[model samples]
Target chain A: GAGVSQSPSNKVTEKGKDVELRCDPISGHTALYWYRQSLGQGLEFLIYFQGNSAPDKSGLPSDRFSAERTGGSVSTLTIQRTQQEDSAVYLCASRNYNEQFFGPGTRLTVL
Target chain B: AQSVTQLDSQVPVFEEAPVELRCNYSSSVSVYLFWYVQYPNQGLQLLLKYLSGSTLVESINGFEAEFNKSQTSFHLRKPSVHISDTAEYFCAVSDNEKLTFGTGTRLTIIP
Candidate 1:
């Protein structure tokens, strides 16, 4: 793809439901990142992947939030037992650690 | 852990008026700085970046940002902003590869 691509632009789930968001980064991008954007809260770094090696996962808010990148290209973010507080725009970005290109984020709303 | 602080939560300016969005950072080591713009319900677009060149860098859209080592600032500015330029701007810094973003500053260009 010419740019990073994310799946399901919008998702609405009930409390305790699980949601999965996917991202397909640009071809040959060595670095990928997942971020969460909430009202009043800035973009929060959730996870990072550099060529399938993720050295950072310190920003995951809880144990329920997890993400993984496979084949160093496609990535998935999973939220277990989703809470209302988990509702936010999940953004996926890919780059070479110099500049990042973002995907149209998935707006996840937990009711 | 490097962090960014966008001084203003919102900035309002008339069309064709000059505007500056303040951003500051805190880090123990040299870092990469970036400015990104997010349009309504859209992905973030890279405006400019300060990697290692001159202290000042300009984006193709006439926006410029100065990387100040003393004040730890990378404030973004445009000589004259257009109504179409209204968007949410974010300041980000990466100590290594984990980018920490600041609370966004919404720029509203009033015609």
Candidate 2:
């Protein structure tokens, strides 16, 4: 069985530019989540989506950060006007029951 | 709301020696605890979890964690470690659908 998968294992972009990171959750997993991992900021929850329910965006640090899961499977995390602070590994996870399986992550560097 | 605290930012242990990584969490209600390990250049992998029933949970790789409700802790321990154990260990707690992760503890095995 395939685990959660993320695209663009690494991305480097200029500050103020927009970048989109993609995630494909395992089939049939109804819950998905995004998190950021940085040297100073261990791991921070970003957003979560559960089935047809509204996604939880409370963990998003600012308005510039947003994410959406379409058709209850694939998700994309978009950062507008990226900042140096946004440089980190973007991780995606899919949950089944109480356990969440994580993806390899996409490292985003804003130069 | 829930939060996790990993007191030690780093833990260096000799191969074949016992090791312990402390993790404490705070939450207003019942919560689920988990230990995720991230090897260098790899994604986070579930090590162990404590959901219900037993106070102690064990992973296949000789790692275990005890959920201590009284102390509000779920510390990970292993009787002996190997060189392959060098990695980053994250302790996370979930009160709802979202997880709160600790800063993470980097484990370095010294041969």
Candidate 3:
């Protein structure tokens, strides 16, 4: 892909249900990141993965939030037993520790 | 820890008007500053960055930001803004890794 790509442009799930969002980063990008953006709010960092290094998981809000980037290409963000507060745009970005390219994003709604 | 602060939550200006978006940061070590723009339904894309030297950095779309170390500010400016420039702008700072962002400023360019 010429840019980062994400699946299911929108995900509407009921509260207490689990949701999985996927991201396919740009080819050759070694760093991947996930962020959450609520309505009219700034991005909240979620996680960052670099090569084979231990992912920087310090930004994950809770144990329910987990992410995995398999083979350094595609990444998935999972929110378990989702709460209404989890409703937001889940954005995926990939970079080389310099300029980042981002996906169109997945809009998650917990009703 | 590095933190960023965007003073304005929203700014409304007439088309072709000059605009300035203010950002401040707090960091204990040398850091990198960046500005990102997000259009509706899209993920964030880098606007510019100030990593080292020159204090001033620019984006391809006529946006420029100046890094002021003493004041801990990286204010973005454009001599003229078009309606297309209306979007949410984010300021981010990173010491060695992991960018911390501020509440974004929504720039609405009115025609």
Indicate which candidate wins on lDDT. Answer: 2
How do all models score by TM-score?
Answer: 0.96, 0.97, 0.94
| Candidate 3 chain B, poorest ten consecutive residues by summed lDDT | B92-101
Q: Where is model 1 more than 4 Å wrong at Cα? A: none
Per-residue error for B54 in candidate 2, Å, reads 1.0
Q: By summed lDDT, which 10 consecutive residues of candidate 1 chain A come out lowest?
A: A93-102
Ranking by TM-score: 2, 1, 3
Please write out the lDDT profile of model 1 over residues B47-82, one tens digit for every residue: 999999799999998999999999999999999999
**CA deviation > 4 Å runs, candidate 2:** none
Q: Can you write out model 2's per-residue Cα lDDT over A1-111, one digit (the tens) per residue?
A: 598999999999999999999999999999999999998888999988997454578889999998888899999999999999999999999999999999999999999
TM-score, prediction 2: 0.97
Predicted candidate 3 versus true structure: per-residue lDDT over B51-95, tens digit per residue = 898999999999999999899999999999999999999999876
What does DockQ give for each predicted structure? 0.85, 0.90, 0.67
The sequence of per-residue lDDT tens digits that candidate 1 reaches over residues A1-111 is 498999989999999999999999999998999999999677999998998888889889999999888898899999999999999999999986478889999999999
Kindly give the stretch of ten consecutive residues in candidate 2 chain A with the minimal lDDT sum.
A50-59
TM-score of chain A of each: 0.96, 0.96, 0.93
